[model samples]
Target: MSIYRKDIYVFDGDRPVKALIRSYTEADFEGLIRIQQESFPPPFSPELWWNEEQLGNHVRLFPEGALCVEIEGELAASMTGMLVNYNPGDPDHSWVEMTDAGYICNHLADGNTLYVVDIGARPAYRKLGLGKWLMLSMYEVVVRLNLQRLLGGGRLPGYDRVADEMSAQDYVQAVIEGKLKDPVLTFLLRCGRTPVRLMADYLDDEESHNYAMLMEWRNPFLPQES
Candidate 1:
């Protein structure tokens, strides 16, 4: 029930690269591992990383939600997500719980929210709009499944530089107001996602101070009530 195929294309420096945005396959294991390692280095610990077995389970559990981008048959970026019944009124959940510490055991087929587990673009392919395209691809999945919203932890890569001067909440607010340009949070905000709250100990990343911005993008295509 995948809404996206491998027909998408994005230009790589005016070269007109033919990119394939599609579901994850066993053959992509090595590529995914390499991308994760390269995209998120030291700050992202080995304990917080996803392995071949965990990623394979995601494909088996929710093939439609697992997406990968290939440029000229080389894996460029990948996004992993799952459907979950999220209660907006409830407190923000930690990354460990949402992604099951990268095991992805929280996926629920009949859930109303699409929880984005992880999304990363290889260092070489950065700024090619691959991340945005992958997100839009997931948005398509949301519309196709009639999900309520898309949820994930938005990393604050620019926080460490300013943490001594303000709180995480204040940093997020500044980013939203365009006063600050956080590498991750700012991009998510630009993509129409809203910061719900600042989550402490969300992950093991020292760059983010183990903090993450709980973000959500409500689906505009949800059916109206009668």
Candidate 2:
């Protein structure tokens, strides 16, 4: 049985001898599913992730150079991120896929930024600097793509009286641990990303309102190539 655990390697002083980051591919489908399912409470469906991993859509993670780590050829940890996209490619007037670029356009004005919709590691692999490594990896992706910034969403369980005193980080944490608050906004701050909006309010009955937190890369001015 393939044990997909602790597959990610952070740039620790020790350096990882047993794990390393690997480019995501179709071959990783089954193992990736197993790892992700075990990582998130409601893991993304295998079919959904497989299609997104390959950009089998006019919108999604298809054009991303995402990376995951494995040990002994077993999927242990993964980071689902993206590179900048000018257009999803319209050789025949094709619609662009909804990757980082689309996510930013949906919230921020047209600009050069890479949005990291999600970045997660298994609980078992926590505190191993995987999160920091993932951030560095994201930085590399941003620089390589000449992206000016990185943006992402911090989803909450909508708005409820229980959240009346909740903070952004609290909401993000809630999503991760099912009891903690959101973490996106705070993590972004630590990653050199800045918050743009922080509004809270009530929602219609039953439906929860997302106290969305929008953040942008510190420097929105990437030097253009001569």
Candidate 3:
């Protein structure tokens, strides 16, 4: 069941098209796979694409965290996540380990953090504010559930070109300072996520040089700890 639903609009040239944001259902499996393929095209590892087992796990384990935006019954964007009792003291962890190899088998029912495993939009839907809406919807979940924060590994797709010119830490700092613009990191930052640290070897993507920035978006409704 979709616990949340919203009607949104996106533009195709000057015409506004209706879109729907809601939790994912088993019916959305094929559309989800298409979005994954479009978002991560050839030259990117096909092995990393969403598999039936992984999608089934998401639908079965944490349906609320599996969400998508649809335009005329066609999926335009999607995001998936799960809850975890995050450990800040030992913050370094691979994407595989954190997401249970994309199965989300380790999802914690009482976890205080919403861990974003993956998010992407079809190329045609980019910059339509669909991503932001999906992200904000997740934030709403954080507030509604009284979670501590939303966490994700922000990719640095723009880092590879400058990998020889600067370290990953310097590259991330530059992006945070607006000296550089990373497709993924910039989008995450604009969505109110702040860099927690530079996480190395987080993935096998050549574009990000296998590094991802750990990002955090704290719930303002939650009281601060001393």
Best by lDDT: 3
Q: What would the TM-scores of all predictions be?
A: 0.94, 0.57, 0.95
Cα-based lDDT for every prediction: 0.85, 0.47, 0.90
Off by over 4 Å in 1: 1-3, 223-226
For residues 35-86, what per-residue lDDT tens digits would candidate 3 score against the true structure? 9999999657788899989999998898879989998878999999899998
Task: By lDDT, rank the candidates, best first.
Answer: 3, 1, 2
lDDT of each residue in 1-226, candidate 2, tens digit only: 1111224444436666466665566666566556655654532223323333332221233334355665555666665544443322212111123342223223232336565644556665654555656666666666655666565544343434455676545655454454533344445556665555444431111223535554555333465332
Q: Can you rank all candidates by TM-score, best first?
A: 3, 1, 2
Highest TM-score model number: 3
Report lDDT (Cα) of residue 73, candidate 1: 80
Model 1 TM-score, 2 decimals: 0.94
lDDT of 1 by residue, 177-221 (tens): 899899899889778888778889888778888889988888897
